[model samples]
Target chain A: MSEQKVDTRLWSSKARNLSPYVPGEQPQHANLCKLNTNENPFPPSPKVGEAIANVLEQQAYDLRLYPAPESDDLRASLAELYNLDINEVFVGNGSDEVLALVFASFFLKERPVLAPDISYSFYPVYAQTFGVELVQIALEDDFSIDPDAYRQPCSGIIIANPNAPTGLLLSLADIRKLASEHSNSVIVIDEAYIDFACIDETNSSTQVSAVSLINEFDNILVTQTFSKSRSLAGLRVGMAFGNASLIEALTRMKNSFNSYPLDKLAQAGATASVLDNDYFEQTRQQVIDLRKSLTTQLTTLGYQVLPSHANFVFARPKDGNASAVAAKLREQGIIVRHFDKPRIQEYLRITVGTQAQHERLIDALTAMQTYSEDSETISNMG
Target chain B: MSEQKVDTRLWSSKARNLSPYVPGEQPQHANLCKLNTNENPFPPSPKVGEAIANVLEQQAYDLRLYPAPESDDLRASLAELYNLDINEVFVGNGSDEVLALVFASFFLKERPVLAPDISYSFYPVYAQTFGVELVQIALEDDFSIDPDAYRQPCSGIIIANPNAPTGLLLSLADIRKLASEHSNSVIVIDEAYIDFACIDETNSSTQVSAVSLINEFDNILVTQTFSKSRSLAGLRVGMAFGNASLIEALTRMKNSFNSYPLDKLAQAGATASVLDNDYFEQTRQQVIDLRKSLTTQLTTLGYQVLPSHANFVFARPKDGNASAVAAKLREQGIIVRHFDKPRIQEYLRITVGTQAQHERLIDALTAMQTYSEDSETISNMG
Candidate 1:
């Protein structure tokens, strides 16, 4: 680190001693193969654009008025889609903001909150921000969250479904067990990738969502985002579904913090996207198919790829040097995510891009393997 | 409020005990005169719509990508406009969100943050949300903040320029004195209504903003919003300007909380609004003119109106029944704000609307006064 001139005295102890989360770099390189962030490969539904234009046109660009503090239309759409009451749905700027409010609203206590150590890193950052003690439980050898490990007195538990950096999913039965065991504390099921984790190919009969247990389990709050499945990352809309009481708690915190976190355009666009189920189904299925193709190619390259139910795959390279592999791909104008943290340093969490993008990445890796084989054969000749 | 089956055990101590803020009601009455929430009466500049459309058209509605987590474009535009470095500008979902982050980042010390009593009510709610102690210094009899009362040990101080509800503005000298006195603590000057607090009619010189003290004092942080003067309340864009080090602290906390609080539409719209200075000036001057006419008519009706430097005037009705007056106005499809809190319950905060809006209000109050005069005359004759 460079020698700094910032006076630490001006910052609070919280700000001075805190470590902030660094999101993936958004390189503006033209024609850059950007796959570091797990954004959907497809754009949002066409209805989203129409709805936004309608808000401006019908209201005559009525951006002067504040949006509905209750986020009435968007929440109603979410409620209908989820088969829950409107009061059971809570909206925010993004799932990050919603999760931050979750941490502030339900996770502050004398006891610590439990999270998988290899899960979303934002968990610990929010813990530090809200002065909540977070105890990170180690995942099992397969990188799956152990439901039994969370059987204790904690203030809350937050687990990202199809956990990031590992892309390993836990069964709904395991989630049910966790919720039943810790009936008092909040069991947050962050389903940012639930759409990609469809149970059946039909995507009609079964959906892998903890939202199904919201009514049966009052403490289970499911946080989802429009960023991944709905492909509205730039719009900044996220929501939570749970019992009305729990949603009320999040709503109270939101009102106290910032009444209108969801902007007017965000509300309109997200509502339209939610109502367009056909486009959503087609796009998410495309991501699932892309993930399947990428996973097969990585395995063929002699990499140990985790069984992913998300729009990304976590794979250990053949040489077990994930950082070097990520760097090599970057040299080829390909950007994949690699975490330098313990236990996951050897893994690269590559988002499933379009077929052509992934083909380029696989082609480069295949060329690298061929070079290794040729070098060995030449050594034998020598 | 009602017989409920909510499981209280699911919530934290904070959510259970904290009192959330309630914003002004957004009534949907067709003929409603909404002078309650202090929203700008005019729409944003046409360039705002054009810029937003360009994002969808040029980027192909690339709402699939995440917004620049750094909020690069918007912050750069603000920096260029304010004559500050980009590092000195921080953006958030709204000024309310920015204020929440400020409270979370700078006010978490032993000494309580201080504010004038009867200032922005969001101050205390943020304090409660972040677990900070807030010491409110009572305003003097003339409804002005006394700087001498703030010279004491404190963690931070936040004063809204042209203080809300009262619409009274403090001189830049007073703000400079506060900053110099509290050099060790953060001095937050919330300039939400600064554009309406113009020094001269030209609005070209001698603007009443504490942004001037940002370079002089490291502790001075000035916050402004596009919602008020820029006519983009529904877009949810706000920013803060200060010394680089102080801004870095806020940036750290924001990264910890929510990386991309501002959406792409907000960034594009607000950037265009900042560049369109002529439209901003014309709309804000119209508000000032409307405020003048409203104040004159209110005074003629025997109401005690405070000299306002904002888009709203704080006035006590002649009958001294603010709730009754507000109720009567509601019956006429007109709405104004009334606070039932201590020391200000008798006053109404009325936003400046169109010339016709104030004329209608004047006519209603005139009829009420005439009825009272007739009643008194008839009683005297009897």
Candidate 2:
């Protein structure tokens, strides 16, 4: 009401102080190479489309009824995929939702929850939203997590494996050590990029999912999403694996928040994608290959590329102006992420796009280098 | 791994004390008359299916990308429908999620929020989830909200118009009074059943929506869902309308919780449903007709039916055994909701179904009455 003069002072104190999570840009330009967000470059499985079409055609009437509250079918598929009991799995709108619930259910304590200072940015936002105290332990100079830093007493712990903006994976042994040490606290291993980190092409046995450690550590929770490897970001499906008691706590949080977080089509499509193992393996392998090629090319160009296990590579430019390089790439219709954080300010996190997109990025960088050399010669003559 | 021995004591104190809201049963049998949850008896518009199919066919690759973080297109559609600015509307996975954010945003004050004693059961669960103190204000003897009672100072207020399980509508004037009285606090009017409460058959002008008061009262936030008259419960889309500042607060809360709460297909389908006014009005009018007929029949069968302004009718059986009657109805493959709570335990909330389903329910009730009389005579003779 313009006449009434709206007042924001009525908002809760937490809302006033809230610094919301800024997700990666979703550029509207169709032709632009979108590498800002770590989305899969390939399309989702054909079975996902078929499953959604089937639901629309046959069960259109049932859209009037609420979806399965617990997303039982989706959970069952995830359980089968991970070789876990159905009760040990929990599904939500996305991995973000699952992680948010974990923070609310397990970490809201008088003591602070421990997390890497430079991990997924959403962790701190969740902590703020839930009124949980968060203690940020800085990553080492090499952008690797120091497990010793997490040994102190805390309410809980969360680590994003193959952490965002760093693209570095933590070893399973290190994760197990942290979980074992935090026996009385809930430890969350956010394995959103674990599928991309699986390097053995000949066998699936090399997949290093924290889900394996669930049975060994009662307090450990592993969260994953379909957005990355499964190529279902638009569908909004994510899952968490843990002991049944921990899963039950997340379930309670979800039910209290929104009874039917997953819609019928999301449940159907996500379940189909999970069952399409061949498609999942093929796309992830393609991304993995591209990451290796891109890393080699960047290294040849005098960039310091981090050893990345995720779909994206975190590298600093030779000139050390990450923001300027990101802007130049944007001018050429290529969008890559550049975080302005303290330690990661000089690095750009680029998603592994298709071969053509990668070539475009290389050409743009080469041209920029040539132009800079020409400009230096002119300045020297003057 | 199995020898580690899990412990439940590690769960946060809040999670341990949580009593999650239980949604209505989604029966697996197709033949049962599901008058338990207040779902529309008709299918959604054919355009909804077409819209979803179009998205799948054209932008299947786009599923690899995250959906619009704010659901701007869907929110724009809702804004157009309500004749309000886009900034005044906020969309979520469902009205439940929207309401949950409202609780976390505006009602988490040090003082206890005020709510009607006999209303949607989820209110208490949300209060507990957000750690907000909630004070229950007793409804009038006729189960209507009294504005005078809400006049007392409190942090915020949430009232369901055409309240659940009671199906009695609160006048817009009363809602305006409460909103005006609580100028410094948010007054939420959940208009989930407003479409069914449009009692004026001659004109649309008589449809009572708190949205009208929004231009006058800055504190009134009206929440509605596509799950009701629009027949999209399975898709899970809901919206809230308020002043820009209040909407901004909700957006902050939503971004902090889950960036993309609405999926791509959900956005497409819900937008199409909002545009299909003919389908929406037809199905709601059909339900309104059936509700009147059902009420008359129930009264003849010795039931005191409440004056309903929703798709469901609330009534107490003359025999004063609502649980037994509900059990009897279930035996006949007819399911209705019966809440065993204070002040309303004797009532049965039956959703208004199609004509054939209503006939089946009436026939079942007649048979039960005859059987009861026969059993009573046999007992007397013995």
Candidate 3:
């Protein structure tokens, strides 16, 4: 279909100038190795399907009723899992929605909010949508967030741990420092990929979650999602853990937007998935293991891979033609993400897939490398 | 849990002053006559259940993948059903979300947007959330919208057809006139309850949908939801029909906010429900018949019931104590909506439920009348 030509005269100034975030392609074909979006290459816990089926079987008639606007059951389940009071949690259709609400609730101030330049792209979209000025702090050469950069006076700060496309994890100490230094501003730690990060054995808990800081810092808001770790991307379930007041602000924004954002099936399925910790641990571990292997394999191919803590890895090819390599991979029925943005145009963000899919991707890259060598030899002979 | 005491210091100025929209109660009890929300009494088409189950059984593993960002499948289905191009339809998590996006897309202008003062209270909340200047025009003494009020120069106009809580249908001629006069501004027609309005048999189609006006008016937008006629309140699917330019603006806003607002199962189930027109017609007709009988019964009990064209009947008790009447109904396990807003404070918006539930409600009202008479006699004797 042709692109729609919107009438700028009829459009709001915000809509006319909106540069919407472009999501990764969700190709409908089944034969391709889909590693573009950072979705866990595994099915969710068996309980999720059962829970959804049960809702259909028993409460199908009750679909006529509105779901609990508060999503109390899911929030309670999340609070129980996180060892926090139910008041500390707020759930939404997805983390995107949660983040959008956070922007509206906490970031619309006279001072500009701070974020990493190359973090989750949706941050700027939300900033623009709410008319909040966002000052993006540049990531360091090694793609790590500098806590000192966020020390400046700002309205708020939003940082994605194990930041997307770069996949580098920020230390909890750094997170605490940022939160402490920016005490006046709401510090939102977007932990969307925190589940895939290596467990911090030195910490009291095995998980490297920023939720622990909520008690000490009332300004800290940790947002998470069931999409990556729990393998429920198709089901839009996201949550945030913060102080009661922060959660209350988000709740107000959510209520103002949509009272029942999470439908019955989503609530039921997400709650069941959260309850199955064993299944969650197993799948997350599998993705972590795959990420390691993929990183090693890419390193062997002379790709300078970043230290990845998420389900995806960011790597620049030694020859520095990421867009070309991505196109080549697509021709071979494999998909990987390559952003044509500044400071990262040469990097490809490849999601860690299952063993078989990884092997297929490796074979495709090997074939391309060998063909490149052959072409070079022929050019030398000529 | 106690009410959360939000720290206003930590909240944005918007969130600090935000008065969130309060949805009707969703009580957990199984036996209550839930006539509070205007939800359809019938279950969704059997096909919706089958479709959801099929998605679970077949693509359950694919839950690991993100849903199509644009919900192209559902949009295509809706376009087919409505005889519009796919680009003309925009879907969201719910009509609330759709409306929120619409406000963000088309109403955030320097000039204030106009809305009915006593209509859906959510409009004001959205205006506050988006920081849009909203001028609430007064409805007529009989609670019908005055189209002339919307003719004034404004940024936009958003009116609920067969207006909520009032259940009075504004004629398409009036809607067309509003759109025509406000040609320079975006005119949004919220048709959340339009499906429950009486079918115009004299028209080419039986349903009274303003979607027909979309082709003629580039500035007009019609929004609808599956919650009312399709009996899928718990599914959370809503759509907007407009010119491609308006639809494109909404798409930009939705993408900027959340890529996959409608989850996989929601897309599947809503599509199936839309395709099942026979079941929709049967259930909608049932609601219309039940509403007629309920209006007659309430009128007999000294209530002035408005001539309703929607799923619920708005009526006022002769004594004019709606809060007291609503409390009395709650005591009898019969819940109905009562707004404390100005101009509509005396009315109770009773949803049209099943015949059995209606009988229970009527019986409770009769018992209340009898008790009131007995109490009066006792007071007189004393």
Best by lDDT: 2
lDDT of 3 by residue, B58-112 (tens): 9999888888888888999999998999999999988999999988888999999
| Stretches > 4 Å off in candidate 2 | A1-6, A199-205, A375-382, B1-7, B199-205, B374-382
DockQ versus reference, model 2: 0.65
Rank order (by DockQ, best first): 3, 1, 2
Q: Compared with the true structure, what per-residue lDDT tens digits does model 2 show for residues A1-382?
A: 3424645677988777788899988879868988899999899999999999999989999999999999999899889988999999999999999999999999998889999999899999999999899999999989999899888999989999878879888989998889888888988999999888854534534958889999999888999999999999999999999999898888888998999999999999999999999988888889988998999998988899998989999999998899999999999899999988898899999999999989999899877876788886686668
Q: Which pairs clash (backbone N, Cα, C closer than 3 Å) in model 1? A: none
lDDT of 3: 0.89
Local distance difference test, candidate 2: 0.90
TM-score for each predicted model, relative to the true structure: 0.97, 0.96, 0.96
The best candidate in terms of TM-score = 1
Compared with the true structure, what per-residue lDDT tens digits does model 3 show for residues A256-351?
899999999999999999999999987787788788899999999999999888999999999989999999999988999999999999999999
- Candidate 2 clashing pairs? none
Q: Give one digit per residue, the lDDT tens place, for model 1 in B117-236.
A: 889999999999888999999999999999999988999999999899899999989998998888899999998998898667455346688888788899999999999889899999
RMSD over all Cα atoms, model 3: 2.8
Candidate 1 shows a clash count of 0
* TM-score winner, 1 or 2: 1
